[model samples]
Target: MANSPSSKKRARQAERRTEVNKARRSRIRTFLRKVEEAITGGDQAAAAEALKSAQPEVMRGVTKGVLHKNTASRKISRLSSRVKAMGA
Candidate 1:
């Protein structure tokens, strides 16, 4: 469908971006999952450490445009709260 030269170039760029973004999203999810598993496992110390490590990864996802700022904030907030509650 992209007949023009610029359109073709754009299509190619989009394809590459999609691949990169997919990997970024997967990486972020992996970090989040680790935090979740630690929390659910009732290991307060491990959950706290996991969340501490994942926090920057989530923020990096925001900076790299893989995640929205507000979305990352909400996730971090909720995860921290759950981790905190685990201590109580």
Candidate 2:
């Protein structure tokens, strides 16, 4: 489908990028799942720790272009709020 040499190179680059992004997304989801499990288990300390660990990972996703800044922020906000509410 890529006729031009530059277009072929660009297509190859996109394929590589897609693979990397897919791996990053899976890793981010794993971190988020840990946080969710901790929250669901009602362990405030563990949830706090999980949140602390996950926050950076989520932010890194934004920085690395796997996720939008606002999207990551919103997820962090919601997860933190849920963790906080677990105290009640």
Candidate 3:
């Protein structure tokens, strides 16, 4: 219960931020899933393209504070490696 007016305002702000962050996280997951589906489906070109599109969305998540920088980098690295391996 937020008794103070300022605290109530903060609570409202937090609720809004939580919804926004949740949507951002879901969007990032969707992008990652697209890449994974492409990779698993054995479409190298589609996988490469999906990875290309996902990289920016993942980085955007990091920039927006929904994901850590290292986490985003690691994900990008692993996906790119898998995409590359598909070519070989």
Per-model TM-score, in order, reads 0.98, 0.96, 0.98
Model 2, residue 2: distance off in Å is 0.5
- Per-residue lDDT of candidate 3, residues 1-88 (tens digit): 9999999999999999999999999999999999999999999999999999999999999989999999999999999999999989
Q: Indicate the worst ten consecutive residues by lDDT in candidate 2.
A: 36-45
Give me the overall lDDT of model 3: 0.97
The superposed Cα distance between candidate 1 and the true structure at residue 51, in angstroms, equals 0.4
Candidate no. 3 TM-score: 0.98
The digit string of per-residue lDDT tens for model 2 on 1-88 reads: 9999999999999999999999999999999999999998989999999999999999999999999999999999999999999999
Off by over 4 Å in 1: none
Ranking the candidates on lDDT from highest down gives 3, 1, 2
**Each candidate's clash count:** 0, 0, 0
